[model samples]
Every structure is written in C-alpha cells, then in structure tokens.
Target chain A: MSTEIAIHIQDIHKEFLLSHSGSASLKTALLWWKRRQLEELKVLRGLTIEVKRGECVALVGRNGAGKSTLLSLLARVYKPTSGTITINGRIAPLLELGAGFHPDLTGQENALFNAMILGLSRKEATARIEPILAFAELEKYRDAPVRTYSSGMLARLGFSIAAHVDADILIVDEVLAVGDFAFERKCFAFIEEFKQKNGTILFVSHDREDVLQVSDRCIWLKDGQVEQEGDPLTVLDAYESGTA
Target chain B: MRSEFQELWRFRELLFAMVERELKIRYKNSVLGFVWSLLMPLATILVMWLVFKVFLRNDTPNFSAYVLAAYLPYQFIQLAVLDSAQSVLISLPVVKKVYFPREILPLASVISNFIHLLLSLPIFFIFLFVIYATYGFEVSPFTWRMLFLPVLLVITFMLTAGMAFIISALNVFYEDVKYAVSLLLYIFFFLTPVMYFSENVFYALKDKPYGMLLYNLYHANPMAMLVTAYKKTLVPMGKIDPGGGEGLIPMLPMNWPMFGVTVAITLAFFFGGYALFNRMKWRFVERP
Candidate 1:
C-alpha cells in the first residue's frame, strides 16, 4: 500500500454500440423504435495495466488502435464497460488541446475555465494567471477570444494552462505535435522538468522520437492490445518492425 | 444522487465562464449590443400594441402595458428554451473531447439569457412608468412580491436547462432536431399567451366553448401561468371579467394558484429533463 500506485487498472474492457446514421430520422426511428438494435462497434477489448507514483509512461498506438479510448477510460471521460480503475491521485488530463475552451472566450478566460475544469479552485488558478499568460506568450491577446487565435496560438494557450495545473498525475495525448517548433521545444523542456520532479505522466504519440525523449518506459498498443512494454528504444523498434 | 448534484455543482464556475462568453459574443459584433435584448420584446410589444389598438379598435384598457407585460416574460421563456435546446448541439466540439458536467452547456445558456433578461428589466419598468404617467393610472411600488419573479425564472430555467439537456443529447444523435426547434418555437409561440391573450383563445373559441379547453391548457402550461403571473403583478388586473376584462384593468395581486402550478410543473419538467438527460448523455460522445 505504501508503494503508492498512482493508477491501478486490471482487466479493463470497453465496448461501444453504434447506431446506423439513419437511426435519428423519424421514419427509421419509428421502424426501429421497437427493435432498438444498434450496430456493434467493439472499440476496446480486455486490457490490464498500472502506473506507480512519479512514473512517466508513453502509450503508443496507430489510429483507431484504442489509445484515445484508453486515455478516456483512464481519465474517466467514459466509464469502462467492464473492469475497474483505482486512481489514487489528482489527475490533470490534457486529453485534447482546447477541449474545454470556448472559441468565443478570451484567452485569459479560457485559461481560468480550463483550470477550473482540471479541478483547481478559481483562486488557485487565478494566482498563476500571470505565469500562464507569460508561458503562452499571449499577454497582449489575453483578452481576445480564442476564435481569433491561430491553431498554434490555441495550442500554446492550452499547453500553458495545462502545464501550470498542480496535480499528482498528468495525462497528455498527441498534443506535442501542436504549436511551432520553438513552442514544442519549450513544452518538451517542461515535460522533462516535470519528469524530474517525479510527476506521473502518461502520453500517447505516433512520434517515436518524442516517446523516446520524454518517457522512462513505453507501452506499444496494437489493435487495443498491449504488444510491448519496455525501454522506449527497444519497444519502438519492435512496434516498427512488427507493423512493417 | 448526492454525488451527482455535487459533481454538477462543483463545475458551476465553468458554467459561468461559458455564459459570460455567450453574452459577450452575442452583443460584441453588433451595433446595438445589450439594446438588442430590450428591442426584441419592445419591438414585439409595439407591433402588437399597434395592431390591437389602432387596427382592431380594441378598447382593452392599458393595452400597451398589457403588451409590454406579456411580451417581456415571453421573451425570457423563449430565450431560455431556444438557447438550452441548442446548448449541447452547439458545444459538441467541446463536450465530445472534454469531460465536465454535460448539463453545464444548457445551464450556461439559461444564465446568459437570464443576464439578457436582467438587461431588459429597466426597459420593462420604463414602459410601465410611461403608461402610468400618460394614462394617469396609479403605479404600484416595487414590492417584495417582485422577488418571486426570480424564483419563477429559476424554475423556468431548470425546466429549460433540463429540456435543453435532453433535446441537445437527442439532437446530437439526430441532426434534424436543430432545424425542427425553430419550427417548434413558431408553433409554441401561439400556444403561449405571447402575441395573443388567454382571453383571445376564449374569444376565438367562444361558440364551441373552446375557452375552457384553453383554460385547461393554460393550467398545464408553465409558461402560460408565468405570463399570467407577470400580467397580474406588472399590469393591473383590477377586474376579472368572464372575457379578460374587456376594458381598463387594475393591478391585481400575484395569483397564488397559478404560482403554485408554475412551481409544481417547473419541478416536474426539471426532474423529467434530468432523467431523460442522464439516460441519453452517455450516448452523446459516441453518436456523431
């Protein structure tokens, strides 16, 4: 118990029932009203994994390979259809950049809102307000609605706020590809510092170099299965060769 | 159940932020800004007043005031319902990717419209005062009873928010709901006592005893009760004739019976919306 596992997942499985597009129309709605059948789309199969406190791990998978679904499960965005996750620490999930942001809201407003969504008290978030502005390099545009921002600007703003959140566990998904190279380098530096401070990090990226650079270990997922879990270099080699 | 409400409540700040954004954006690029909130109901009342007084030669007493009272409350209800219905559908990009209380989208619409309602209040009262001064009708002072308006609005809000949650969740699965809502509101307008009065329903249906049917519908419809309550409080209903007091009316006290009905039905809608929303919300992210 003292080992302090930040997250514990055992035998987790998820399945989704997707309806045909015509399910919404009144004609089909009436026809299928009684039958109520949905086409089955099995997005996630049975899987098991865990992460200890202060561990930095990378989750790698191809598109539709269930990496996003797994992250969603871990973040409790979607409850698992089966199995359970015991998460003991505060989780700040940068699940998708700008996910909670309102396009019409100013940058500063979005930051506070994003902070609150990530579970920080308004006052706590407000105290770091200046730092967030400085980090995003959007001090002049803080009052401008995010709609006015470029995708890179939006990503920068999102990354800045996500970085400032105080949490025991952080979950990041494919957002390293956002922003310019300079901003990306800055973000990687932040990730390295966070790793050094013993913050538990879970990230997913198709970029093997990124996985190798930031993660202490890597988990390679293929078709919703954990294909390999080990040092980033070896796992990437195996995943690449296997897919090849 | 407790945890559910706590989870929803804890995210109240997020709701406020979204509401603030909505209000600002709504008024920002426009020349009129907050005036548009006032103008919608004001213009509606002006048009109706002209039609009732000049064209029809209808001698209904304080017709201007009647239009103002009825129109304002109707706008509040309209704004709340329309915004709530679209909340989830519009915020799909955000809600699909992020995890927060899904109810906040519709709830935010309610708050933003409620702010617009607040902005429109001065206009409502100013018109009342103008009618009072010009026609020499004694005006009622601001009273504690006015506090009940918020209570009523809140109930209306919860009802709309819940419906918005349900409709939005449904709309996510069925895109046509977005188009259907506008048409629905068009029919809903006549159903409520917005352009016409409950008296008009009876007048139009007098030969068939249709007024009684309308009265029944009135009792069942929370918005009808609310509009009537607003009339009772704001426009003097000094007389309760069989046909909506054909002439001058005096301010009557708030109708407690209608108030009770409004409260009860609002609760019913809120719970109904909640149950439906909870049942449908899980399917939202996956639907599209």
Candidate 2:
C-alpha cells in the first residue's frame, strides 16, 4: 500500500454546551440566553492525528475520554467545531448497534439501505446482501423486522454491512463490544482483510487485547487530547500502567 | 453548496427507498391498509355533502367536488409539512450514527405524502362521477385545462418541501416547531380558498383601491394559489348553474401574472429551505 495519508484531522476542537434541558422548543430557545443554564463541555480539545492509507489504529481510553467523539468526527457524524478534517476516500462507519437500522424494516431492507448509505450502488448492495446476511448468520431471519433482533444480532448485522461496503476508510466505535466470540473473531478477520486491501481503519475500544491484536499503532486519548501514541504494545502498557 | 447537490444526486436511490419505507410504515400491519388511507378523504367528502348540501340547504350544485379540490391539497400540505417537522427528531439516533445527505430525512417525508396525495385523487374523481349521475347536474365541469393538474401539484410540492426543510431543521433546535406548525396550518386553512371559491375573494376586493394588490398578496400564499389553481384547472371557470341558485359563487379568471410570481416565490422557498437545513445540519449532533 502507498504511504499517502488517507485521514487528516488537524488541530480539531469540539465543544458542546451542556444544556440542563435540551433546547428542543422555541419557547425554551427564546429563554435559553436569559436563563444562563448552559455549561461548556469540551470533548475534544485541540487534538490532531493522521492515518496513512492501509493502516489500522486503535484508540484506548477511559469513558468520556473523547475516543468515541474522535471516532464520530472521523466518521463525519459530527463536525469539529473549530478545526478542519480532510479525508481522501469514502468512509464506512459502524458507530453503534444497528446505527441506521429501522425497527419496522426487515433485516434485508435495512441491509440494503445501510450498505447503500455507506457508498454502495443499488446493484452492488443487492449483490452483497447474501454474503452480509450469511456473515451475520441471520439468513433464517432475513425477512424479520430488525426490531425483533437482539442487541447482539443487531451488532452482527451492522458489522456485516460495514464489512461489505466499498469504502477506503472504516471508522468504528464500541459496536463490537456486544457481539459473541465467533462474531468478534469474524470481525477481527475482516479488519485484517480490510488492511490487506489498503483500507485505513480507526477504531475505539476498551479492550487491551483488541488494541494489541488488530492495531499496528495505538493512541491513548485523555480528556480529548492524545496522551500517548505509537507501537500498540508500548502504548497499551503505558495506558494500562497509567490508569492503574 | 454545489457539492451538497452532487452528494444528494448520488444518494437518489436511497431517497426513494426512504420514501418507500415511510409509506410501508404508515400502514405497516393494519388489515385495512390502503383502504384506511382512502377512508379519510372519503369521510371528508361525506361530511361536506351532509353539512353543505343537506343540512345547510346550500344549492351550489356539485358542492363536495369544490370543497375536495381545496381540501385534498390542504391535506397534502399539512401531511407533508407535519411529517417533515418530526422526521429529523425521530431519526436523531440514526443521524448521530451515520452520514447521508441530511436533506433526505425531510425529502422522503414530503415525497411519501405526495404519493399519499396521489393515492387520494381517485376518491375525488369517483365522488365527482357519483354527483354527476345522481344530481343530473349541468354539463360536466372538467375542461381540457385539467391537463395542468401536474403543474399545479408541482408548485404545491415546492412550497411544502421548502416549508418542510425549514421546520424540520428548526424542530431539532426548538421542540415547539411541530405544535406551532399545526397551529399555523389551522390558521392557513381559513385563510386559503378551501371551504369557498377563489371568486369570492376576488369579488370581495373588486372595486377598492389596492384591491388587486390585496388579491395578489392572498394568492402569494402558495397554498391559496395552489387550491385556486386546482379548482380552476379541474372545474371549468365558467358558470356551473344558469339558475342563479343560492350558494352559487362565480369562478375567477386565472391570473397569469400572479401565477408567474407565485411560481418564482415557491421555487425561492424550496431553495431557501434547503439552504437553511444545510446550514443547521452539522450542529444537530451537538444537542444530543
């Protein structure tokens, strides 16, 4: 794989105004400035990173350490408030369990819609449905509504569709945290396969072994900034020891 | 902005799938299904016939047909805009999880409701046929100009979509948007030419200074113009009853210049709505 950069997130800062009550109505919004009930919650503060094409990087962090927020920004689910992110290829993100699944839609329908949204054409997504359902081991429930699926089933299907997308970069969060052992193994195998195909990956995890097994590099985020980064074993050791 | 359009074009297939999903979910497991969809307008026709023709003793000849021409379009406007107002809020979880053209959320709602509007059409035609046969009404009111139904619908679509974009995005920030929108529609129902004919408004403003301007202003409300245009195209502008019966309001001539202005403004609303949505989309995830 060429060493060209695939993802460039530079000097990114993201902040959310922690509203005690969400300003979901005009009446509240009109009084929002008057009440002064908002507190600034800065999730990612002046963070920067770059991922080369075909690299697999894992992020390990404590809860609220900004790892998920960083992954979301890369996925383009949330834009950085005070910085620019330049991505050079199509991105397929598996951010949560059944991220885009509609409860009323059949598994097959959700698969097609999810795959299409991830940059697959109708023909391409249709062709991949069998393999996707097969990978998720959901062939028996293909026509069943997604709402009927368990959380594990949802994760399996979400991963299967993201695996099939024709994307150059894949961003993942704790989506794999809920699936079974065999499903997790299958996901790791797919990540290895994706890496071999020159795909860039950025993933967030709480598992140390997952960081070591899949990531060539590991980044430890602390309070929205990169505290440490480099060889997975070294960073993992640092992260674990530092947390301990 | 150009990139946004290009991205939306690339996801056009997804848009249609979303529209299909919306339609499927509306009547998901109900046994009556499509019949349930037709029942609302049918009931509207019945109530109009009972109240206007029987109870009020109004002899405008084919009364339900007139009310329906206006009522049907208003339903389309209300259904599309109201559904769109909640579209983003309902899909917030998915919005925070994935990325597609955010505009698709509201666009799908508008389109599915447009299909609902299309599905509602046959009932109107069926009611018209029944009235013609039962009442021995004068020669059929439909003229060749009925071909312009699609053009009138297109204008109404632009107006609703524009309003949907603005409201759906605003709703994410202000929860009151949906309630306010329904309230606004209630007010507009009275303002537009839904219960009565456009000719009534024209005659009311006939001779006074700035009367033409006032008429133009009323038609500028796209809903008002759309319903009038629907009646003008569907029912002949000429008199339906030569007997000069009670409740017989004259039909107004099609105002070509005002129509041109309305079309331009409707296009502006559509684009303006889209622009506002795009501006607000990136911040949607912040509140959650």
Candidate 3:
C-alpha cells in the first residue's frame, strides 16, 4: 500500500496448462475427450518482488526461467494463479515491438493505432504522430504500408510510440536487441532521459553489459523463483558465473 | 459489470480505431471498394427474385422488396457473427502484448458489419422505388411507423453483437466454433421466415396436428421476429386506399406479442453473452 511502490507483486505463481493437441477444433476435442491430457507448466512459482518509483530494475535469467512471464504478469497481460499484483501507474509496455501493428496500415497509421491501444486519445495520438515519426526516422516512409518496412524500421516505430506515451512505468522485454547499433544508442539515450524524468522501468534482457549500464537493481530468476536480487554487479556476476 | 463498462468507456477511442481499421482493411485492395457493399446485396436480391418470381412462379406482391428487406439484415448478422467469431484468435498478438478491453475486438467487427448494413439500406430503398414505378407494385408511402425502424435495427444489432461476443470468445478455446456457427446459420436461414412468409408456414401446416406448434417455433427465433418487425414497420409505409388499389399483404401478419417476447429474448442473450464473455476472457491469455 506504500505510495512509493510502483509495482507490488506478492507470492506470484503462474501455471500454464499445455494442451497436447494444439488444435482447438470441436472434432479433435470430442475425440480426445477420454484421453485428453493437460500438463501443467509452472512458469513462476511464489516469486515476490517490489519495484519502487523511479527505479530501473532488470530481470536476467536463462530461457524458461520465467523472466518474460513475470514481466507479462506485471504488465497485467496475464493473471497470477494465487497472488495479487498491484500496479500504481500507467504502464507503457514494449513487450514485442510492432506486435499490434497491422501489415496493411501505413507506418503513421499503425503508430497512431498502437499509441491509442496504449491509452492515448485520438487527438493526442494524432498530435504525437509527427514527433513519433521524427523519432523513428520514418518520415519518408510514413505513408507506406508497414508490410514494406524493414524489421529495423518496425522496431524503431514501435519503440518511438512506446517511448512517447509518457507513462509512469515502462516495461521493455529485450526489444532493443533487434534495433541497429545507432538506433540502440538512441534508445539508450531515451532510457536515460526517461530515468532522469523519474520514470520507473522494468527491463528484461540477456545482454550483461546492457543490464549493467541501465539498471540500478537486478533480479535473477532461477527455476521459476527469484534466486538473487539487489546490487546490479553482484547479482549479475553471480548469475553469470553460475550459468557459465 | 459496472466497472467493465467503465473500462470499456475509457478505451472507447481504441474501439473506434479498431473498427476503423477493420472497415479500411476489408475494402483496401478491391477496385469497387465501398460500392461492393451495395452490389453484393443487390446481387443476392436479384438471384432470389429470379428463383422465387421467375422459376417458382410465386405470387407474393412486392416479392423483391420483401426478400431484400429480410435478406440484407440476415446477411449482415451472418457475416458479423462469422467474422467476429475469429476476431479474438486473429488478434492474438495484440491480446498478449497490450491490456485493453478484449471485447473491443469482437465489438469492432459487429460495428463494422453494421456499417456495411447501413450502407446497403439506400440501395434497398432505391430497389423498392423502382419496383413501384416500373411494375406497379402496391407500395405504401412512408409513414410514421418507419420511425420504429431504428428500434428494430438496434435490437438486431444487439442480438448479433451478443452472438458475436459469445462465439468469438468460445472460438479461442474451440476453433470449430466458427464452422459450427456457419452451419447453424444455414439451418437458421430455412427455419426463419426469411425466404418465405410466415403465412406460408401456417397455411402449409394448418391441417397437421403440430401445425400451431411449428408456427410458434418459427416465430420464436429473435431474428425471425426482427425480420417480421422490420417488414411491418419499414416495408409497409402507409395504408393503401382500398377503393383504388390493392394494399400490401397486411404487413406479413406479424405476431405483436411474440415480437415483444422476442425483444425480451434478445435482451437476455445480450446480457448472457456479455456475462459469458467476461467470465471466459481471462482464459484467453492461457490459450496458445
């Protein structure tokens, strides 16, 4: 309940039921009714974490360590099985760049749609369209369908829209890994500026140097639970040595 | 439920944007563009007219208008339900990436199809005017009853939207929901009094033991009642002077009390569909 706590997650446990037959057709379901099997994949098990206002926290873990699951839960994209999550600020999630953009829409149109989906009004999204296009360096291709844009261009537009939302909390999940070096540098600069403006960030990345450069604190998830947390270097060093 | 509405209200802009996206993408590459909406229904009306009036030698006055009125709305509901059934599955990426009212996706489909239905209305009116002028069909002038068309349209929208919500959410869990819906629509087309008049069903089965039961069952469908109500309110504009000309076939003999019952049933579907959708939506994220 503390006012300073930007995100409060308590004893979070996430279990996904993996259907053996991926087809959701009624015929398949009826045929498999007697032999239907669901294997529960426990992604996050009783992991507790609290992120404070203006804190930049990085989650580092190997694949299947539930790093992305935790971020998704925090973003309210999925509900925890038996725990409560309280987020105190508007969140701008860059989980997967251009995940919501339609291929048929122009770059500017997709940016506006993505911004509105992230909680901006039509007028507000329209007003920010110019700045977003400018930041993404997509002015020349603003009218072109996004299907024609390169992957780097899509990432740029996605990052630009996410960055301009002016949200209290920003969640980035390895989105920077796709951008080119120059755009990555521009993104890092924006992240630093965002931090200076008192924004809370929950970043997930596998890059060691990038984690060290941006985060004030680090949480290492291991086998669905937090193995270590606190000082960035200490935890990262321990995590690296353990993985190595 | 109240909080859900409040949340939907907060994301109203997103809803509008989604609907706009659907409409634009639907007609994007087609040369005819928006005109296709009018042409598709007109083509259906033409085929139905040839089959009923020419081939069968049917004698229903203003048969073209009657078929167009019923068929246009039927096509709208069918398309809306069928397309919206896949709305959630199609937007899986967006659903997993962002947090908004998931209902907006299916709702947007409903609204976009509703727009198409609205666009086709003018063509329907023009068809009616042409039949009256050229064929000397007994067409009533516009009347005060036409004001009730909007109410009937709203009821139809609510009914289709509700079905879309239920089918689309269920579709995420069972992909066959779309196929099953399409099959059911086919059966429903024959069951409802769309292609034929309700009076035909009554007269054909009048001597049978369950004749009344069969007739009542036909009118029980909300869509049937809606079509009947639409014909009553919109098709028959005013009473034709009996001394000079023949009047249209008594507004297709609608059952008023059953119409009220159908309205209540549609409202119930809307509430039930909304409840089921809200309950099942959290499981959507769990699905692949």
lDDT of 3 by residue, B68-150 (tens): 88888898999999989999999989888788999999999999999999988887788878877785655553557778878
Chain A TM-scores in order: 0.92, 0.92, 0.96
Q: Candidate 2 clashing pairs?
A: A24-B174, A24-B175, A25-B174, A25-B175
Q: Please give the CA lDDT of all the candidate structures.
A: 0.75, 0.84, 0.85
lDDT of 1 by residue, B202-284 (tens): 45565666666656666577777777667656665544223444654333455577678778878877787777787777667
Considering the two chains of model 1, state its CAPRI-style docking category. Answer: acceptable
The residue-level lDDT of candidate 1 at B125 comes to: 78
RMSD over all Cα atoms, model 1: 3.0
lDDT of 2 by residue, B1-288 (tens): 789899999899989888988888787778898887678777877887897668866666566777887888898889899999999989988888778889999999999989988887877777777767786766775578989998898888989999999999999988887898999999998899876667767777867799988988888887887887887777656543212243355665787887888898899999998999999998888863
The runs of at least 3 residues in candidate 2 whose Cα sits more than 4 Å from the true structure, single-residue gaps closed, are: A1-3, B135-137, B203-217, B238-249
Output the number of the DockQ-best candidate.
3
Candidate 3 ranges beyond 4 A from true positions:
A31-36, B135-139, B237-252
* lDDT of candidate 3 at residue B285, scale 0 to 100: 86
Error in Å for residue B70 of model 1: 1.9
